[model samples]
Every structure is written in C-alpha cells, then in structure tokens.
Target chain A: EAGVTQFPSHSVIEKGQTVTLRCDPISGHDNLYWYRRVMGKEIKFLLHFVKESKQDESGMPNNRFLAERTGGTYSTLKVQPAELEDSGVYFCASSQMRTGELFFGEGSRLTVL
Target chain B: ELKVEQNPLFLSMQEGKNYTIYCNYSTTSDRLYWYRQDPGKSLESLFVLLSNGAVKQEGRLMASLDTKARLSTLHITAAVHDLSATYFCAVGSNSGGGADGLTFGKGTHLIIQP
Candidate 1:
C-alpha cells in the first residue's frame, strides 16, 4: 500500500509570501497529523484531523498557519506571509483511529528567503 | 506542557560497539514511540512502547519503556555503519488511540563508523 505522500517536496518563497503544502494519506486512514522541524531541532506537533474534523489544533504556531482536511482524505497546510523562521521541513503523518502507529511522508521542505 | 528530552544528542562510535540513547519526559504519557530518520528522509517508525516494562526489539535495535520513571531507552547492539541515523523518542498525550499529538525530543544523532 502507498504510504503518506506530500506534494511540492521543496518550496522556496520570499518572505511575506504564502505557500500551501498538501498531503495524501493512505486509503481508509482516519487520522492525519502535521508536524514541523525547524533548524534541525525537535519536531513539534502542529495539528491533527480525524476524518475531516479537527480533533486537536492546539499545536498550531499561530493564526498565520491554517490546516484543513475537507473530505477526510487529503489535508493541506497553508502559511500566510511566511517568515524566515518558517523555513523548515513540514512532515505529514497518518494512522488509524484504533491503531496509533503513525506512517510519515516525505516532508515538504519550505525555505522562506 | 509536556516535554521530552533526549540525552547524548550526538554520538560517534565504531562498528561492533554498543550504546544506549535515553529519553525522558516531563509529564505522564500513555504511549512512547521510537523513530529513525536518515539525512533528508522521512521519520520511520522503529518501535512503540505501550505500557510500562514494554520491550520491543528488531535487528540491532531494542527499545524499552518504564512508565513509572517516565523514561525510555533505545539500545543499539553491535552497531554498524548502516545504523547511523537520527533517533527520536515521542510521547503521546492520550491513551491507545490516534486522537492526540505527540511531544518529541530533540533527536539523538548516531554515527556508527567502521
């Protein structure tokens, strides 16, 4: 089975610009999560979605970042007016509701110059 | 807030040597997970310790958890060059389900040389 897949493996944008990253989870998976790693530091949790519903978004850094899972299949994370500190790899993970073994995707590397 | 800390953030060892990486969390958690990541690669699930005294082993790596101490250890046995990668330990906020976000430690970067 195909694991989680993310789009725009790498994205470069100027400061104050906007970028959207997409993730496609494995089929029938009910849970999707977003995490970010900055400057080779610890990977921090961002948010989680359970079948199109936002279960916990407490990890969202700020209002500038928005994540959505419209139909419960794929999810998107959008950063508006990206800042220099936003340059890092954003990883998307998925798992079943009952089983918590998360499967991660090749991260979307964002560079804000 | 839950916090996870990993010690020996960087390690360089020769082949056939053995080393252990430690993970400690500040708060009580229900599950702990170990992951491996090579340079520029995605996080790969290594082991998941669900309860206290849980131990899981695969190949040269073994991971164990002690809930009472809020500590987990990843032991590498007879390390090889292929074992060089960054290892991370994460704690889940809730119990057995996939409803919570994980708090992760700064990864331990391991280098096993020949």
Candidate 2:
C-alpha cells in the first residue's frame, strides 16, 4: 500500500508571499494531522482533521495559517504573507484508527526569506 | 499544556555497544509513541506504548514505558551504523477514537560509529 504523500517537498517564498502545502493521506484513513519543526525546536503539533471536520486546531500558530480538508480526502495548509519564523519542515500524517500508528508523508520544507 | 522532555539531546556510541535514551512527560498519558527520523527524511514510527509497563521491541531497538513515573525509554542494543538517526517520543492527547495532536519531545540525535 502507498503511504501518505505530500506535495512540493520543498518551497521557498519571500517574507510577505503566500504558500500552500498539500497532503494526501493513505486511502480510507479517517484521521489526518499536521505537525511542524521550526529551526531548532521540537516538532510541534499544528492542527488535526478528522475526515471533513477540524478535530483540533489549537496548535495553529496564528490566523495567517489556514488549513482545509474538503470532501474528507486530502488536506491543504496555506500560509498567507509568510513570516521568517514560519520557515520549517511541515509534516502530514494519517491513521486508520484514531489511536493507531500514524503513517507520515515526506515533509515539505518551507524557507521564507 | 503537556510538556515532554528527552535526554540526553545527543548520543554518540560505538557499534556493538548498548545505550538507553529517556523520555519524560509532565502530564498523565496512556498513549506514548516513538519515532525515528533520518537526516533529510520524514518521521518513521517505531513503538507505541499504550499502558503502564508496556514494552515493545523490534530488531535491536527496545522501547518501554512506565505510566506511574511518566517515563519512557528507548534502549539500543549492539548499535549499528544504520541506527544513527534522531529519535523522538510523543504523548497523545486523544481519548477514545478521536484524533488529538501529539506533544513531542526535542529529538535525541544518535550517532552510531562503526
């Protein structure tokens, strides 16, 4: 079976530019999550989507970061007017069961200059 | 908010030796996970500790969790060159069948020299 896949493995944008990252989870998985590792910090949770619903977005850093999962299939995270601190590796993961092992995608490394 | 700390943040060990990495969390959690990430690679699932005293091992890597102490351990036996990677421990916030974002510890960068 194919694992989770992310788009544009690497992205570069200006400080005020916009960028969007996409994630396609394993087929039939109901739980998808987004996490990030910024600079030298720990990998932090950004948000989670359960099918078409936003399960938890408490970790979203700010309003500039928007995430959408339409039709409960794939998801997208868009950062508008990206900031320098937003440069990091964004990871996407999915699980068939909520508490089961999560399958992760190759992260999208964003570089905001 | 839950806090997870892992130490030592770096480990350099010779092949054929043994070493242990530790993970400690500030809050109570039944779901603990271990993941590995190679340089320029994504995270790979290693172990998931569900309850107190849960133990799981694969190949030369063994992971154990003690819920009472809120501590989890990853033990490497006879380390190999391929074992050099960053290891992370995460605690889940979800209950039942819901998805909750994980709280991860700063990764332990391991180097196994041959």
Candidate 3:
C-alpha cells in the first residue's frame, strides 16, 4: 500500500506570499493529520481530520493558516502572507481510526524569505 | 497543555554498544509511540505502547511505557551502524479511543559508528 504522499516537496516564497501544501493519504484511511517541524525543532501537530470533518485544529498557529479536507480523501494546508517563521518542513500523516500507528509523508519543505 | 520531552537529544556510540532514550510527558496518556526518521525522510513507525507496563520489541530496539510515571524508554541493544537515525516518541492526546493528534518530543538523534 502506498503511504501518505505530499506535493511540491519543496517550496520557496517571499514573505507576504501564499503557499498551499497538499497531502494525499492512503486509501480507506479515515484519519488524517498535519504537523510541522521548524528550524530543526520538534515536530508539532497542526490539525486532524476524521473523514471530511475536522476532528481537531487547535494546533494551528494563527488565522493565516488554513487547513481543509474536502471529501476526506486529501488535505490542503494554506499559509497566507507567510512569515519567516513559517519556513520549515510540513509533514502529513494518516492512519486508521482507533489505530495508533501513523504513516507519514515525505513532507513539504517551505522556505519563506 | 500537553508537553513531551526527550533526553539525550544527541547520542553517539560505537557499534555493539547499548543506550537508552527517555521520553516524558506532562499529561496522562496511555498510548505512546516511537518513530524513526532518516535525514530528509519521513517518519517510520517503530513501536506503539498502548497501555501501562506495555513493552514492544523489534530487532535491536525495545520500547517500554510506564503510565504512572508518564515515562517511556527506547532501549537499543547491540546497536549497529544501520541503527543510526533520529528517534522520536509521541503521546496521543486522547486517552480514550479517540483519533486525536499526538504530542511529540524533540527527537533523539542516534549515531552508531564502527
């Protein structure tokens, strides 16, 4: 089975610009997650989606960050007017509901200058 | 707030040596996980400890959890050069059967040289 896949493995944008990262999860997986690692720090959770509904999004940084999972097959994280601190690797993970194991994607590296 | 802390953020040892990485969390959680990640790679699940006193072993790595202490340990036995990678432990936010996100540690970067 294919693991979680993310698009635009690397992205470079100027501050105040917008970038969107996409993640395609494994088939039939009901749980999807978004996490980020900044400046070689710890990986932090951003949000989670169960099917098409957002289970929890408390980890999102601010209003400038928006994540959506329409129809539940994939997810998109959009950062508007990105700041320098937004430069990091964004990882997407998926798993079956009630199963603690998570399969992660290759990650989308964003560089905001 | 949930927080996870890992100790010995960096480990450098010779092959055949043994070392243990520790993970401690601030909240009460029964589900803990260990993951391995190579440079510029995605996270690979290593072990999942579901309950108190749970222990799981694979190959040269073993992970054990103590819910009462909110601590988990990853023990590497007779480590080889191939075992060099960053190891992370995460605690599930929801103690019950919920698909909540995890709180992860800063990761233990292990390097085993010959």
Candidate 4:
C-alpha cells in the first residue's frame, strides 16, 4: 500500500503571504496527525483528525493557523499572513487505529522570507 | 503536558564503534517509537516498543523499552557511516485509545566518521 503523501514538497513565500499544505493519508487509516519542526527545535504536534472530526487541536500555535480534514481522507493546513517564524518542515502521518504505528509522509518545507 | 528527553544531543563516533541513545519520558505511555531522519529528509520509522520490557532489533540497531522507569534506549552496534542521521524518540499517551498525539524528544544527531 502507498504511504502517506504530501503535496508541494517545498514552498517559498514572502512574509505576510498565505500558504496551504496538503496531506493524503494511507488507505483505511482513521488517525491523521500534523506536526512541524522549526529551526533548532524539536518536531511539535499541530493537530489531529479522526474521521472528519478533530481529535485534538491544542498544539495549534495561533489563530493564523488552521487545519481541516473535510472528508476524513485528506488534510490541509493553512497559514494566513505567514511569518518568518513559520519557516520549517511540516510533516503528516497516519495510522490504522489509535495507538498504532504511524506512517509518515516526506514532509513539506516552508520558507518564509 | 507530556515531555520526552533525549541524552547526548549530538554524537560523533567512528565506524565499528558502538553507542546507545537514551530517551526518557515524563509520564506513562501506551507505546514508544524510534525514528531516523537523514539531513533534509522526512522521518523513517525504526522500532516500536509497545510494552514494558519490549525489545526489537533490525540490522545494526536495537531498541528496548522500560515502562516502569519511563525510559527507552536505542543501541547501535558496530555503527557505520550510513547510519549517520538524527534519531528521535516519541511517546504516545493512552488517551483516544492510543490515538492521542505523541510527544517527541529533541533528537540525537549521530555522525559516524569512516
């Protein structure tokens, strides 16, 4: 089976611009997660979706960041008025069930200048 | 909040040498995972430790978990240059029936000089 896939492997935009990253989870996987790693920082969780419903979103950094999984299949993370601090690698992962091993995508690298 | 800590934030070893990376978590967890990431690449799963005293090994890498102490270790036996990369350990909480988010450590950067 194909693993999780992310779109626009790399994204570069000016500060104050908007950007959207997409992720397609593995087939039949109900758990999808979003994470990002800033320069010199560890990977941090952003949010989670379980079959179209948000399971957890406490890790969202600010109001400018929004994530949604409309069909519970693919997910999108949008950042409005992106800032320099938003430059980092965004990773998406999916698992068959809660507590199962996660399969990760290649990640989307966002650079804001 | 759950916290994961990794020791020796960076390591440089010679080929044929052996070393171990340690991961310590703040609270109890349903499972622990080890992942490897090469420069500018996404993470690749290495080992999944599901229970206390669980051990798994593949190739030159081995991982073990000690739920009682909330600790996990990744041991590299006879390291090679190809193994140079950053390693991260993640702890999964029991919430959502293991569906909860994971807390990851800062990661260990391993450099093996051949």
Candidate 5:
C-alpha cells in the first residue's frame, strides 16, 4: 500500500496570508492525524480524524487554524492570517487501526515571512 | 497531561561502540513505539513494545519496555555509520482499538562516527 502523501512539499506565504496543506492517507485507513514542528522545537500534535469525523482537536493552536476531513478520504489544514511564528514543518500520518503504528508523510514545510 | 522524555538528547560515539537511549513517560500507557528519522526525512518505525518487559530487536537495534517503571530503552549494539539518525519514542494511551493519538518524546540525535 502507498504511504500517506502530502501536497506542495513546501510552501511560502507572507504574514496575514492564508495557506492550505493537504494530506491523503493510506487507503482504508480510518485514523489520520496532523502534527507540526517549529524551529528547534519538538513535534506537537494538532488534531486527529477518524473516518470523516473530528476525533480530537484539543491540540489545535488557535482559531486561525482550521482542519477538515470531508468524505472521510483526505484531510486539509488551512491557516488564515498566518504569522511568522507559524512557519514550521507540518506532518500527516495514518494508521490502519486507532492507536496503532502510524505511517508518516514527508511533511510540508511552511515558511511565513 | 501525558509527557514523554528521552535522555541524552544528543549522542556521538565511534563505530562498533555500544550505547543505550532511554525514554521515560508519565502515567500509564497502552504501548510504546520507537522510530528512526534521518535529517529532513519522515519517521521510520523501528519497534513496538506492548506489554511489560516486552523486548523487540532488529538488526543492531533493540528496544525494551518496562510498564511498571514507565520506562523504555533502545540499545544499540555495535553501531555503524548507517545507524546515525534521530530516534523517537512515542507513548499511546489505553484507548481501546487505537482511538487515541501518541505522545512523543523530544527525540535523541545519534551520530556514529566511522
């Protein structure tokens, strides 16, 4: 099976601009998750999706960040009015079972100037 | 809050040397996972420890978990240059059937100088 794939491996945007990152999980995988790592920081969880439902979103940093998983297939993360601090590497992962081993994507590097 | 910590955030050793990386997690967990990642690359799964005293070995790397102590160890035996990479340990809660997400440690960067 193909691993999780993310689009636009890198992105650059100006402060106050909006950017969207997309992730396509493995086929038939029910669990998808989003994580990010800022400069010199550890990777942190952002949200999780089970099928088409949002399982956990407590990790979301702020309202400017939005995530959606429609049709339970792929997911998207949109950052509006991006700030300089938002520059980081965003990773997407999926597992066949909930809490199981996760397969990660190459990650999308976002640079907000 | 669940917290996972890995000791010796940075390690540099000569090839053929033996070293161990430690992972400590707060609270109980369902399982512990070890992953390797080259710089600028995605994570690669190495081992999964499910129960107390569970140990798994692959190639020159071995991972063991002690649930009672909430500790895990990744021991590298006779390391080689190819073994250089960042190692991460993740802990998962007992949310039946994998409903929960993993909490990861800060990761240990290993360097094996040949």
Candidate 6:
C-alpha cells in the first residue's frame, strides 16, 4: 500500500506571501493529521481530520494558518502572509485507526524569507 | 500542558555496542511510540507501546514503557551502522487515538561506527 504522500516537497516563498501544502492519505484511512518541525526543534502536532471532520485543531499556531480536508479524502494546509517564523518542514500523516501506527509523508519544506 | 523529554540527544557507539535511549513525559499517558528517520526522509514507525509495562521488540531494537514511572526506553542491541539515524519517541496525550496529535520529543541522533 502507498504511504502518505505530500506535494511540493519543497517550497520557498517571500515573507507575507501565501503557500499551500497538500497531503494525500492512504485509501480508506479515516484519520489524517498535520505536524510541523522547525529547524532545531522537535516535531509538533498541528491538527487532525477524521473523515472530513476536524477532530482537533488545537495545535494550529494562529489564525493565519488554516487546514482543510475535503470530502475526507485529502488535506491542505494554507499559510497566509507567511512569516519568517513559518519556515519549517510540514508533515502529513495517516492511520487506519485511532491510536495506531502513523504513516508519514515526505514532508514539505517551507522556506519563508 | 504536555511535554516529552529525551536524554542523550546525541549518541556515538561502536558497532556491536549496546545502549538505551530514554523518554520521559510530564503527563500521564499510556500510549507511546518510536520512530526512525534518515536525513531528509519521512518518519518510519518502529514500535507502538501501549498500557503500563508494555514491551515490544523487533530485530535489534526493543522498547518498553513504564506508565508508573512515566518513562519509555528504546534499547539497541549489538548496534550496527545501519542503525544510525534519528530516533524519536512520542507520547499520546488524552485517552483517544493520536488523532489528538502526538507530543514528540527532540529526537536522539544515534551514530554507530565501525
């Protein structure tokens, strides 16, 4: 089975620009999640989607960051007016069940300068 | 608030040596996981340990969790160069699935040299 897949493996944008990262999870997987890892920092959770419904989004940094899952198939994370601090590797993951092993995608590296 | 801490952020060992990486969390959680990642690569799941006193082993790596101590340990036996990578331990907060997202510890970079 194919693991989680992400698009635009690398993105470089000027500060205040907008960039959207996309993720395609495995088929029939009900859980999709977003996480980020800043340089020199640990990976941190961003949000989660279960079959098109947001299960939890408490980890999102601010209003400038938005995530959407359409029809419970794929997910997109959009950073509006991206800031320098937004430069990081964004990872998308999916699991067959809750509390199960997560399959990760080749993360999208975002560079906001 | 939830926090995960890992010790010996860097490990340098000779092939055939044995060592353990430790993970400690600030809150109570029964679900813990270990993952491996090569440079510029996606994370690969290694182990999922749930419940107190749970233990799981695969190949040369063994993971054990002690809910009473709020600690999890990843033991590498007879390490080899192929075992070199960043190892991460994450603690799942709340009772539900990791859909809540995992609180990951700063990874432990392991280097095994011949």
Tell me how candidate 5 scores on lDDT: 0.91
Best by lDDT: 6
The C-alpha interface RMSD of every prediction is: 2.4, 2.0, 2.1, 2.2, 2.4, 2.0
Residue lDDT tens for model 5, B14-44: 9999999999998889888999999888989
How do the residues A59-89 of candidate 4 rate in per-residue lDDT, one tens digit apiece? Answer: 8899999999998889999999899999999
lDDT per residue, candidate 2, B1-114, as tens digits?
Answer: 689999999999999999999999988786999999998887999998898888999999999999889899999999999999999999985443443888999999999999
- Give me the runs in candidate 4 sitting further than 4 Å from their true place: B95-99
**C-alpha TM-score for every candidate:** 0.96, 0.96, 0.96, 0.95, 0.96, 0.97
Runs in model 1 lying further than 4 Å from the true structure? B95-99
lDDT of every predicted structure (CA atoms): 0.92, 0.92, 0.91, 0.92, 0.91, 0.93
Candidate 2, residue B88: how far the Cα is off, in Å: 0.5
Per-residue lDDT over B1-114 for candidate 4, one digit per residue giving the tens place of the 0 to 100 score: 788999989999999999999999987789999999988777899988898999999999999999999999999999999999999999987755434778899999999999
Clashes of each: 0, 0, 0, 1, 2, 0
- Which ten-residue region of model 5 chain A has the weakest summed lDDT? A95-104
Best by DockQ: 6
lDDT of 3 by residue, B1-114 (tens): 789999999999999988999999998885888999999999999998998898989999999999999999999999999999999999986654443778899999999999
Residue pairs whose backbone atoms clash in candidate 5: A98-B98, A99-B98
> Comparing candidate 1 with candidate 2, which one achieves the higher TM-score?
2
Supply fnat for every model shown: 0.72, 0.78, 0.74, 0.68, 0.38, 0.80
Clashing pairs in 2: none
DockQ of 3: 0.65
